[model samples]
Target: MAASSKRTICIVSPGTARDNNGNWHTADRWARFLRDDYDVVVQERWSARWPAPDLLVALHARRSARSLGEFREYHDDRPAILVLTGTDVYHDIHRDSDAECAVLLADALVVLQPAAIGELPDIVRPNTHVIYQSADALPTLPGVPGRKDVTMVGHLREVKDPATFMRAAALVTAPGVFLQQIGAALDADLERLAERTNDTVEHYAWQGGAPREYARDAIRRSHALAVCSTMEGGANVIVEAITSGVPVLASDISGNRGMLGDDYAGFFPVGDAAALARLIDRSVQDDAFIATLRAQCAARAPLFAPEAERAALLRLVDNLFHSIPSIGKRT
Candidate 1:
């Protein structure tokens, strides 16, 4: 039966509205997806201020730790979900007390891609679910009339490893291939490096940070997207690329593997610029390789459809609520 009344859900994300980061994007998207079924509010952090929500969905265990603890303390049986991020899984949860506490408090854990599940502790495994981030199914567009550019989107944080893309640009043998890097610099050193690389590397440009639509437009028109992250919960850029009918050449990390499948041919080793260069060269030199990557990415597109993600998210929340006896009793 359909619900009699709308439920109130609160999302706790560390990213600010102006951050333009992955966490902010996920929080924003999920709020829109849940709005029809529930009254959703996206917050930088959960507070005990105005009114209590029926459920809480906190992104980044460590970042939202205090908020999670507050909600759980007041209503232990009320449904709460902990969404894991790159830092949470790859680093924090293992050593950070706050992140670990969040793991113990949540009724369910959300991993953006399947491989993230492996990063969880055995005790947290049973409750964890993979929720692939999504994008609308865009019709394939005619190729852009410009020099071929492969773009990489992600802030110039150490984890994103923009250096790999820069180094790979210097190594590729393919002619007429330009590299475009999007996103702001989180590290001063990396920012300086990008500037230097742009001047020295042939056919490379760093278009530091752009509006979401601009980044999406760049990806949609590019020959392929390159993602060289050292760690990722699941890069939102990956789904954006796939749904836009652009193929990705990603780092061979679990997060990328989880999204693109382990056997995906478009992956290069993490930090291996030469290998990425060779792969990029092959993509530029051989039409078949490019076609194969596009085909594989196309097959994964359905999994990232908006409807599919909304359904999975609803089911996970609904199941958790129904199983917990005190779900509706909490005030």
Candidate 2:
């Protein structure tokens, strides 16, 4: 590539990468969006052997802490964008020094959902931008009327609270209702809970981990998606559900509220199985309530569309290159 050509941008996300999975999917998605205008490379980490790029976009403050630090040391004057994840905003930024340092070192910051802006310190707030995660709208499946199936999509971790959905299923006394939880178990306790819940008579099933296509297909087929996370920076699952036109029954957290609006009617208190159960029962029994949620979700769906995200990303890159003196010299 010549100096006058499009700038080469490197995205450094130290956490695991997947061809098609949770957070990795978000990283890959952004790379695909940027490919048309910039030379983009996605990597697990940055090291001494790697060639320096015109700009750096690192994901997850905590997991990419070392990479962020190293890039700052080598390319302090380069345009570097730090993207925050749920764990980084909700937990690490407050407690981890390395994570906090990553925020200060970046030229600009990106948060997937809107509410995350409030979590930043006063100084960092000015450079922060909210980029709502986007998804490709899947082909809509034929509406299977009268089937009372609710779906939850997330890996079984301490933050995800898979048990909340299981316990909620036990409390639901609705006749035809069924609860399906999908995700890999990362925690031993959650794995045991899944086993115990399966042995019981409640209308719950742990389908374990499925391929991304199968999981999204399941979301498209379901009546609603259950989001029971204790904390989230911005969940891509929320985007998937909204883009699929599936209504959501989410936990009442800022992250969830950020994706769904603050005025959204379908939130239950986090970790409260009874509250979740009541919402599930209401969604099945009350036609007006379900329709209301679907309407709200439909109204918000465009925010996560692929075109919107691509526009924001391109605009950010354009603006950064124009404003930053050293980066502007590259092209």
Candidate 3:
């Protein structure tokens, strides 16, 4: 391990605290985790105006590409850990030159889920490691006595497919089935659609952004989580739901499959609102099916424990800073 007396670590997140998105959440958690052993701080990006730390953990490859590239240019002796977000792995790196440069320049790469490993180009695969995100367990809270509430939480983004959630809400025919969506209207067009959804769909409610604690409580109170995202590097919400003893009904995508496991029984076809609606109905009426989902979630929850995430992150930093030779050094 590196000497602990005065180590400094910097986290660069594309999303800032005001955004309260997944990237910010991870950066904030890591800052807390490393604060005791290292001088840790979180910022949207690093520039020549600010002091560089001994190490950099950047949250988005494409979005933070300038920060990553400039760090190598300016410092040339330290290490930068480039964390690949969903778009970075599946979309950005393939088409975006900045993302390509970020990967090439990284001393180490972090992918949030195991399955994302296959998406990396062969040249960078050896340097990459999977680090699952985590959420602390919430105290159990009961849902309305018999109501079946399913929730999908994410900002209104194209990749998240909130429209799917809205359509699924309309299609659900099960008695006492309620669908709630919690997210900011990041996209104005999408926000309008959600408004229409709420007005037309009696059981669907689109509650805009809430406090972090309120969101946690909402997840705990819901009977199940519907993660209809089309892409995810790894969603923190999955960890939150699983650790809170909630089962998930997710879209059938590698990201969700990667986090929830291949054998997880609760997947509906991606973007197929009818299929999602059917799954939601089944969750309410079939006790045995719901039990199976609960069992599968319980099995996966250990992988997302706070202790596990903290250890993995620290170990990654220890090896990158202490054991491995630094890359991008000008000398």
Better model by lDDT, 2 or 3?
A: 3
lDDT tens string, model 3, 161-206? 9999999888999999999999999898899999999999999999
Q: Please state every model's RMSD to the true fold in angstroms.
A: 2.3, 2.0, 3.0
Task: Give lDDT tens digits, candidate 2, residues 1-331.
Answer: 5566777888886654543455578778889999988899989887646888888899989878888788889877778899999888888999999899999989899998889888888899999998998989875565456667799988888899888999998899877888899998889999999989988946788998888888888888888899999999878888888898899999999999999999999999999999999999999889999999999999999999999999998888888887774663553
Question: lDDT-based ranking, best first?
Answer: 1, 3, 2
**Per-model TM-score versus the true fold:** 0.95, 0.95, 0.95
- Residue 177 CA displacement from its true place in model 3, Å: 0.7
Model 3: residues >4 Å from true position, as ranges? 1-4, 324-331
Q: Lowest-scoring 10 consecutive residues by lDDT in candidate 1?
A: 322-331
Global local distance difference test of model 2? 0.86
